[model samples]
Target chain A: MARTEIKIGGFGGQGVILSGYIIGRAAAIYDSKHATMIQAFGPEARGSACSAQIVVSAEPIAYPYITTPQIMIVMSQEAYTKFSPELAEGGILITEEELVKTHNLRKDLKHFSIPATRFAEELGRKMVLNIVMMGFMTSVTGIVGVEAMRQAVKVSVPKGTEHLNLNAFNKGFEYGEKLKSGAA
Target chain B: MKADPKGVVAGAYFIDGDHACAEGAIAAGCRFVAGYPITPSTEIVERIAERFPLIGGMFIQMEDEIASSIAIQGAVWGGKKAMTVTSGPGFSLMMEHIGLAAMTETPCVFVDVQRGGPSTGLPTLPGQGDMMQARWGSHGDYGIIALCPNSPQESFDLTIKAFNLAEQYRVPVLVMLDECVGHMTERVVVPPADEIEITPRRYWDGPKEGFLLFKAGPDRVPPMVKAGDGYNIHVTSLTHDERGYPVMTAAAQEKLVRRLIDKIRLNSDAIVECREEQTAGADVVIVSYGITSRIAIPAIEQARREGVKVGHLRLITAWPFPAKRIRELSHHVSCFVVPEINYGQMVREVERCVAGRTRVERVSHGGGAVHNPKDIYAKIMSCGKEERK
Candidate 1:
């Protein structure tokens, strides 16, 4: 079975785990693939340097955690520094552009940056930054379909915040489409 | 029996194993739960506490693990399908009650989401160290049923199975989950209530006068009569006769204890469930359970690609240990490799069942994390080279 290992790293309350959950639900529920997500535990999850490990596969996944992630998303500098070295060769690295400064990136790897926090703020709620990043990740990697992610976001978010979250997702997706077209 | 339609939350959701287990208990008609919350296991009771109130069930946060363990038993005799949830440390505290449940033939569920431990070790990490304890933790020789679940889905499904087995055999059934599977989030599809099977408790419906509390039924499982049923019955830990009276004689002890043990030992074929793959003409077989079974898959696949004939025997029911099947596979397989979170626990059983007919090796760990598939693959490579008969 083909498997994709994805890791999302950020401090707690940044919705790092929730972002992982949305992607996992999108793939497993909407895209009809098997998805498993494991959140970092203990004190690390309380406030600092938390992470979520995800695996999406065509078949039932075994050996749940990622050894070297094929896709790494980082929202904080600590996470980027801690996890960037373990990214697989030619892996895609997505980052929160305003929160982290990228330097000495591996030449073989592809780097994609999004001002997710800014996008969320534009939507009048900063907590939706994780959703913004998810939209960006979907457009950049095409890991999950646009319609599937929209459906996952609706079911996953709080009842009243669906409209705002969808707008945040579309803003991020629009920017990603510009980047893909070499216009940004 | 079909599950009560009201209890089932029919939907597909992304949830963790602990939450799924709570849903499973709710679906299985468990109306009473007592637990002193502990890490990796607390989420189970947390969900129960939130859901129980609205469902006409009871969730009690007892003073300690000891209280939590016995409270479920008290509720069981009161005629509620009941359960207690705990981790390794709390599980140790509940050991005495587990034995008591077995002796009294109390049908109840005990969930142990295992963590690393000699004593409260790795409170938030995964370990299968309690595998032996679940089987032989309590003092004295008695039989119990234990099921180990590998994923969030199994955690949900096996919990219902645990309650069913507990009712079917009138024994205490343990749902053994490690920290990894307990906390990992996955797509868990909880089916419609009518689609789910429920095992109704074997309650006596006979005339209350002169009713025997411990009389063996056709399958050797005694029917339970709820407390205050007008039948004066005695349930005790001491050796007792069918009348449920304390019979201190050696003959009484023999009769009571043997039935307790043989109820499981003789009816093992019905209680045992293992997932076997590729055993035919294989040189080596991998025996594992819980999260360890899933971790061994990649290594098994790697070995198969390298032209090694390897099979997997995953224990869904860890106790009433799948001895007969292991013995049958032992005749053809050249060797066995066991990898678990603990240094060596269930591997001993694998060795015993193989009976020197084939060599056995252990890829052991101390329980902070899962086995690196490469290390398991290394062991499989060496075991595959054993001289086959």
Candidate 2:
């Protein structure tokens, strides 16, 4: 069976992990696929670069960690610096446009950018930036269905705040759709 | 019997292996847990600590590993199912108590979420280096039961199995989990409480007048009893008679130790469980446990893609080492490829069981990250080119 390896990277407390978690829940719980998520753990504090590796497969997962990711979604400059080069040729690269700047970009891959941090601020919850990224990634990459991603975000966010997170997700998803249609 | 419906959270979860183990322990009716928080394994006790209070269970964060290890034994003797969670350094400290549990026939589980280690090597990385330690580090010739779980689901299932085995054999069962499996998040489907079968504690119900604490029943497993229920129980770590008194004689040692080992050895056919895939007619059979078994899949498939017949034997039970199956496979396969996180721990067991009947190829590393599948693929390819049996 085919396995798609994805990496989500950012500093601590950015919900980078929850972003990966939502995708896994979407794939494994909602989409009926096998999803495994492994996050980097070390003596890490806030603002330190960290990453989560996710593998979604049609069959049982083998060799769990992401050796070379086919999808790289980075939200921090440090994460972009450390993980972008590891993306395989012809992979999809999604970035939080307001937080990460592109340089020494690979030519063989399709790159999409979204102002996730700005979208979250517009939604009045800066912490939901990861959800915004998740929405944008779902629309741009189509790795998971939009409905499954929405269900995952709804169930994963804190109680009584699902509406706001969904708004943040909708903002990023709309922007991604615009980018796909060359309207933005 | 079915599990207590109060503790079973019947639903699907996206959780790590450690958390799944905690849930499994609860679903299996574990009521007391004493542990010292260690990385990779701490989440187990943390989850247990949170859930225990609601279910009338108790969780103690003991001062150190030594205290944590022995505390569970105390809880077991108090008529409750108990367990202790630890990693490498803590596992080392719990060795003496493991011997204590074996000598006293304490039914409890010890969970070692192994990390890269000799000391405090890689606190958060994965390793299967402690496989041998789980079997032999406790000292003495008493038989032990250890289980290796590959993923979050197995971590849940095997923890319940570990507790049941511990109760049946009245021995300390080790749930050996590597950091990768313990920390990796995956989908775990928990069935309803009524669907989960549990092995209730084998309690002594015979006349309490002339109770001999250590006397073996027909199954070679002595039934357990509560201490304050008018039954005088003397449990110890020394070589003791059926009366639970230390008898420093060699004959006493022979009887006590022999029964301890025989209880597990004789019942090994029932205790040992292994999952074999595609070993019917293959050139190489990969013997692995814990995360290494899952990591070998791509290598197995890669070798197959290159026209190599590679079979895989994933050890669901590590201790009592599945010798009969390996001996049978030895005559049928050309070689056994063992890929483990340690330099070579379980490979020795495979060799001992194979007895030179087949080529035993080892793919090994120290501890830390998992083996590169390409490296394992290369080993399988090399072994695949050999003559078939």
Badly placed stretches (over 4 Å) of model 1 are none
Query: What's the DockQ for every one of the candidates?
Result: 0.89, 0.91
> What's the CA error at residue B204 for candidate 2, in Å?
1.4
TM-score of the first chain in candidate 2 relative to the native first chain: 0.96
Find the candidate with the highest lDDT and give its number.
1
What range of 10 consecutive residues in model 2 chain B has the weakest lDDT sum? B380-389
Report the lDDT tens digits of candidate 1 across residue range B257-350: 9999999999999899999899888888999999989999999999999999999999999998999998998899888899999889888998
> Candidate 2, residues B4-55: lDDT per residue as tens digits?
9999999989999999999999999999999999998989999998999999
How good is the docking of model 2, as DockQ? 0.91
Candidate 2: stretches off by over 4 Å? A44-46
Superposed Cα deviation of residue B208, candidate 1 (Å): 1.4
Ten contiguous residues minimizing lDDT sum, candidate 1 chain A: A118-127
True contacts kept of each: 0.90, 0.92
